[model samples]
Target chain A: MCGQNMLDIEGLVLRRGRRLLARRIDLRVDRGAFAYIVGPNGSGKSTLLRVLAGFGRPEEGVIRWSGRTIGEWGGAYRGEVAFLGHLEGIKPMLTPEENLAYRRLLVGPTGWRVPTPSPFFDASALPDLPCQRLSAGQRRRVSLACLEHSAAPLWLLDEPLTSLDHDGVAALGGLLARHLMAGGTAVVASHQPLPPTLVPATVLELGTKR
Target chain B: MNGLLGAQLRMIYRARGDYLAPVIFYVLVASLFPLALGPSPRLLSLIAPGVIWIDATLASVVAFAGLFRDDYDDGSLEQMLLSPRPLELIVLVRVFAGWVSLSLPLVLLAPLLALWFSFPPPILPVLLVSLVLTTGCLTLLGALGSALTVGLRHSLVLLPVLLLPLATPVLIFGAHAVLLAERGLDPRTPLYVLAALFFLALALIPKATAAALRVALEV
Candidate 1:
């Protein structure tokens, strides 16, 4: 019921052994906004994104979605968020079409029986025949396709541009722009600047430790 | 309703190598015992129960090695944990898929293997039924073991060590069912006990597997 902000983190801190990955970081992403988290390796950019995706707990401080704590949202509310990490999450053995169908089945609306049988189910439209056989860029595209059908309000992407070629990057940039233009919020962790169209986006940069 | 089950079914069907390998291994392992025991009908029949049970149990363990490994490696496990379905229910579906891919085929081929051992036809039904029931238990138990050892370096060895003891009752009842049927006596007691073990594992292993996955993921 609480729909104030899409995401909010306050006094968040994360530590690995004696080292601080992120220290007392306060960040917020309003509904429909595009935000980028930038940092060098080991600067906790991925860690921050993972925390917001609800994949990890902050050692200190709190993360709130809408107006409630992340843990309080329950499974249904949490399902409204999709995450894409650096690793291509597609199953290597599954054809691109099957991978997309499976992902849709995982996050799609209820009563959505698969083998969706729609023209969109064609594997040819996908970047490759199957994920394992695909080029790195092609695999990333397949994963992106899965993300597009997620129907989630929020997207948490970590280094999504890593293996993408020029065209692939532009295509992804266009998708993110479209997503934000349609009132969806996104938090991206990447070193590259997205296309200019994805403007009005906020940037949070983490400085190197002394 | 369809979301969880559909994802599980796809995972099983698409990973043909992971799914089929264990059943083939089961048949090969079971077949070896008879060949090693030298085609003596009496000896083959006498040891068939033990051979089949051991092979089935070992096959369950082999099949489970990939249960969470694929998901973990591909990063799908995190997505699954974060999905709308309860982790326990999702774990159950994964176990169900594992059973179908690994144990179900074993059950179907069990009778054919029994024939090679000259097992009596009357006892064949009991052998098949016992295998079906016991495999269910092994699948559930194996799921728990796989979840616990998800990221461990020695999970290949650890899984069997963890699961074999828990599978003892299943072996006992399954073999007893064959023994009773061979004498032309009703094996109802052992059959019921095996069924009960299956149901018990079906009821409880999901929660245990879920908890184990949580710990494994955190580590």
Candidate 2:
């Protein structure tokens, strides 16, 4: 459903309550671009990513996906964006498989579906075990499976490395690289530098001057 | 979404405490009238409809607090707003499933609770019907309450303040239906009113809830 349309942000302003976080931020990332959103704490890295994700609206901005404005896209905007954040977005009472399966269904695709475990996440480990019983890392992995199953063209990740072990990080990085290779766009908010292999196509750094 | 509904269904299965709390509260509150008012059958029967209705309303309010809190806590509310379906559909399905999972127990136990209030066999079916329909009204309204107050630290205090005003009319219609049934004064009119309220609430409240949830999560 997407062509080579680039994501464009023109003269954006981001704010939290009364405090202005970023001013007149303009950026452009072509389709399939991997843009690392780097910023110090309180610098609005997450806020900018959120605007792209359509999670929370910014104070003022114009964001377009594949040449369509966010407002014009309406409910269909959700179809193209995948957002994963620090909260893991998994229900504690649901088992990993159940959570993954349910999230897949949440996007409204039809036909028989099943949760497939990823090497990064052991969602297959005790498929019936509720998320509350899983350790923090394990639960985070289950949440990662939600990301793996999504078909959206745009990925917005906010501090997504939380609670992941070394192997999990490698697995995720590999997936990110693969997603870029497959012509998907991503805006990842993280301080960690990308592995040399996928040195992100561009860097969108956010923060007011010191 | 069927996926959301299935997940919600599984969620309630694990939360035995949440499911059982309202029924226990319903019983305890129903039993309170007898102790406080001195167990005269006349007084008990006279106040029975209001007592059960009030308890049910209170139980529904309590049940709704957890409804959207989890969405906020786990950050699923943000994702839910971004679901491919409109936010209204998500709120509708979740609220309907929540009503079934949490409040339906109270509906099933309504007859027994009514008996405690001296509801005779003749009025029992009407009482059940009233409870079922009002349960839908309160739950839809409560879903709106839950959405509007989702992320705030003080949302619990605000919930009742927001919900009670909306809920008062529904309760009156529900209780009056029971009273008319007890007196055999052609309870059909109030019952029809209750059904009308139910359908209106079903049609409209979820859209309001979805709007409120968007404000809560996005703004």
Candidate 3:
């Protein structure tokens, strides 16, 4: 278990358009650990999360997951990583239950028969209408529901707290605790602080920290 | 794979407009030929094969214009990119779902189109066979064009223009196949060529489309 189950980045340089964002960054996060990416607006936190999720290429440097380069791991690596971007990844035409069921099918072996409701809401209380008819906070909860059924080991979440209620935050805190305890690793990019129940192993600030 | 297919089919069902556009467009364009050319059965049947082939080609363009644009905009394309399965297989499933929901209707409507063109009843099966192969080729090729333009703003205006030239070969062979059948000839030569083109697209286009999608996500 020399390289073990961990993410290692070295001399990373990332950019957006013509402007370079961050340079010479190195970090590591082990299994059962959490890393928080924080910075002000336009700080490349989201870009870093995208790179970590294997969506974008770094301008310079190498990222190794569990001792293998992501290119080498390829689909095997993607199968283990669950990504949630700013768009929330839900179809507006499908209900919350339908969304969660489809998500579960993609990441796990579950059939779409009986979808488990979002833990953030009452089981019988979710509206049967399409998610587009729901409020912003409700849609965010549905997006968070993907994390619950994902069963993916590495969660790369960007702005998971964008539109959640107090109860939704608490439920997410609980879910994160369970995932970490089960030996899952998470890399989150957020403008606000996560719930107080869990502490991050590393806080990597992007751009120029004030 | 079954799960992806099921979810995709459900989405296709929910967004009825996307699939319906091609079917409606095909029928409307095919009908215009009979109207615009005057009602001589000899003249209509003579040009029927080319007219229907062109209609299918244009319909395919409409069908595949937004193949990946919605997913790209909504970030589901990003999620699909991250699926554990090979991207090529995922792309193939998507194209297959599109073919079923968008192009199958055109195949089903063959008899009506044949009737309108005064095509002989005996040639109906041949026409259907040519359509199945031609549409499959056009859809696969259009999926590649769609993938390349997924992240661009003007993709809708550009897709058909780029695809029509590339699709010309399929149109020629498919129409020729049916024309031969109408002339009471074997029609096997052009039919074999259409089969080859369809199989070639089947073998190659999904991989290319998947690669294009990966590039689209990068920038």
Candidate 4:
């Protein structure tokens, strides 16, 4: 793992089609920092998270992770990131257990730092069943399970709160708290306000895009 | 690296049922030509090279829908896009796995299919060689097409349109080589062209497909 835990975004200008989504934005997040990028519908929350995740290039900006430019880091940076986009990324034909089984491979060698699913994980009804048989909330849980044992220090979650039940929401908050306590960083893009029980995080809410 | 490849192989293995449809489609298509043209063995032998080549190409297109569709729909594509594994290598492995599971059967089954066409037995080896090499080239091109269109709605139509112009050369050289082998003439020229295409695809298409996949996944 790199010795640094900082994400520095300077003068970020994001666009979609001909419209300006979010522009001239700057933010800095240090190790163990939890950040929420809140925005209304069509406000570029997903686009911004995607840009930071290296899925989409911003029109203008520099994003630095652990002191290296994400571009220069290139494929190496992917190993350091656990990105969960709007989709659960689940294979409907495979069981939940089968899906997350590939996580270690995708992230490369995690050695012994793979986080085990704990009592707080609420993995009660997740395994064994083909993912197609699961409900939306159940599918969300299975997808989040990928992050439960993630070795990557950076988590880029897009709309993680969608379709989650109260219990599922609390489980996610607990996981986030644990990740923060362990010195990892998370960038959660959601329109929903976080539950009351979670730890405080730096909030970067984007105004509505007309 | 082993883990990544293992997981990819596992996914392919688990989806063994999916590989059947295209091969079956290939046979069904080949069967139609014999029925349409009547039972004349002489005529069947005459058109055999073109008939088999067309079906093989179409059968690969049948396999194309599955190439990236499952991953894109269920979100595994996102995981793959962001995985620490090099996108180019991931694409290469995907194409390789696809060829092994999906196209290898078509290659193995070609001799039997060739019998239906009354293709001269002497040319079977040459047919297999052409199938194996052409299959690799098609899979590479098909993958690049799949990656480019994965994020689009109604890309099934778009895929073939994008692929056909590029695929015309593969068809020309592949079928021509098989015909030359049939006639007992030296098929070296087209065989060399197919080899060149395979190596070029091996070196270049993965990077292009990877870049296309990145664009497809972008919002």
True contacts kept of each: 0.46, 0.65, 0.57, 0.76
In the predicted model 1, the residue pairs found to clash are none
Model 3 lDDT, residue B27, Cα: 95
Better of 3 and 4 by lDDT: 3
Task: List model 1 lDDT by residue over A1-210, tens digit each.
Answer: 346547777898876557888777777788878778888888888777767777656678988888888778766665767889876778887788788766665655652222222322234586545688888777877777777666677889998887777777777777776667667889898888776666745788775563
The numbered model that scores best in TM-score is 2
Best by lDDT: 3
lDDT of 2 by residue, A71-181 (tens): 888877888888887788888888888887777667766312232333445577645788888889888888877787777878888877888888778878877776776
lDDT of 2 by residue, B94-213 (tens): 887888887888888877776776667788888888999988998898888887788788877788888888889889999998898888788889889889989998888888888887
Model 2: DockQ score: 0.65
Reference-based lDDT, residue B144, model 1: 86
Determine the TM-score of chain B of model 1: 0.95
Candidate 2 has an interface RMSD (Å) of 1.6
Considering only chain B, report the TM-score of model 4.
0.95
Clashing pairs in 2: none
Q: Which CAPRI level is candidate 1?
A: acceptable
TM-score of 1: 0.90
Give me the candidate number with maximum DockQ. Answer: 4
Clashing pairs in 3: none
DockQ for the candidates, in order: 0.43, 0.65, 0.61, 0.66
Supply candidate 1's per-residue lDDT for A91.
81
Model 4, span A10-117: residue lDDT tens: 889878878888867787778998778877888878888888888877778888899888889877887778888878887777677777666556655651154555
Instruction: Give me the displacement of residue B96 in model 1, in angstroms.
Output: 2.5
